[model samples]
Target: MDGDIYKIVEQPLSPDAVAASVGDPAAGGVVIFSGIVRNEKDGRPVKYLEYEAHAAMAEAKMREIGAAVRQRWPSVKAVTMLHRIGRLEIGESSVLIAVSAAHRREAFEACQYAIDTLKQRVPVWKKEHFEDGEVWVGLQGG
Candidate 1:
């Protein structure tokens, strides 16, 4: 995880750039996970979202996730993770993760684990904006 990418940005996220960051010559499979701001949540119509994070702590947690992924999947070659802070419109990507591995299975599994763990542990919060109101939510699994 020392060389892995872990970032919290206030700008838009690029899936292609994230994927390229984790590209490895020896990797046979690369998986990218893009978490977007959907138009609705729990049946409520959402107009937008705002993400905030403890920048240093969030990046540290992401690094921990990357290290854990590599430890669990020995074939994982490279990893990249990014979270976007500030306002985001519907359909905008809020998070991007990329994992490169020797096999497709490993890449897919590791990528899944990374995102799940990130949601559970990262120091980030999201506020969903609706026509009626807005609510702040922690980055935790439901």
Candidate 2:
């Protein structure tokens, strides 16, 4: 919606592709954020991460974030938000966000806002698989 690229995919995410999606002639700068799965979390070794989401609702929320960014930073030329679902190995990118704007400040700020809002508002959930067990993130004491 609103000509922004927002989607939830099951395949591995590509930061380059997501960044390219927001390329625009009017944009003087582009900013991208890639959320990667680390080898450890809270001092525990992590085996992998599995992500799930209400696809339709997640996309809708992402679109809302894009709209909010545009409204806050009118200089933004384009925005792209892509999140990968399914099992993800350590070092793999779980989410990618790209924003293009007339200047670097707008691009950077909007990109930051996009990812921050996404984590707090989107319906996506992640399960962290540790060596001994797995726990759904965001649960109490998880």
Candidate 3:
């Protein structure tokens, strides 16, 4: 794709769907990683999470990551990234990254890099709701 294939949705995401979307026979290796909302954060209970995003800017940024992966690893066949918005309960996946490549190494690296960079640079915001209170998390990697 020439433009952003990355999607940030407000509804629940399906990992199998995302994985199937990027599956290619030419690619011998496929790697998928999910960033889940755990029941606890730093030993504290977490009720739910709400994600917000600057749709246009966030998507543009994700496309940049995918393009960069393609450029860095020519063996990579495809890349797909999905992040969830709105209220999410604990144990739900908030983000998913899938990559296919000729070898396992490239797929793993590209997938990891995509998620890491997306968290640092993307215009998405997350609010954590706890029993006591709620707080927005950014650039913290928590």
Candidate 4:
């Protein structure tokens, strides 16, 4: 998936690394957003985060999102998205989004859209480890 939008890796995520990985000269603006494992959520202490995914489907969905972004925003230059798997301690990056566009607005919008769509559509799930226990999220049963 060279041209595809999604990437899954067991290694650590870095903003500068992602920036260097998805560089396009046609774009004057590049935007990157990183979602980190915070110490608290809903006023509860979060110790760590563990992520899992249906790798094949997750990657395909990410590519679809990238294509949709390009189609919706003609000015979009390039897109790069990466999600980490396995256990991550507090303050670690869970998701990274990189977008390049002719202007800032397109980049911002595309990046936001990519992350939002991933959460809603992608088959990735996360388990939050708290001081008391752990709970797996994103599995809304019928």
Q: Write the per-residue lDDT of candidate 2 for residues 102-131, one digit (tens) a residue.
A: 999999999999999999999999999998
- Model 4 stretches with alpha carbons more than 4 Å out: 1-5, 139-142
For 1-142, candidate 1 gives per-residue lDDT tens digits of 4558999999889988988898888999999999989999889899999999999999999999999999999999999999999999999999999999999999999999999999999999999999999989754365
Instruction: Write down the worst ten-residue block by lDDT for model 4.
Output: 1-10
lDDT of each: 0.94, 0.92, 0.87, 0.85
**How well is each residue in 39-76 modelled by candidate 4, as lDDT tens digits?**
98789899899999888888888889988989998888
Model 3, TM vs. native: 0.93
TM-scores, one per candidate: 0.94, 0.96, 0.93, 0.92
Question: In angstroms, how far off is 39's CA in candidate 2?
Answer: 0.7
TM-score of 4: 0.92
State in Å the error of residue 119, model 4.
Answer: 0.7
TM-score of candidate 1 relative to the true fold: 0.94
Which candidate do you rate higher for TM-score, 1 or 4? Answer: 1
Off by over 4 Å in 2: none
Candidate achieving higher TM-score, 2 or 4: 2
The TM-score between candidate 2 and the true structure equals 0.96
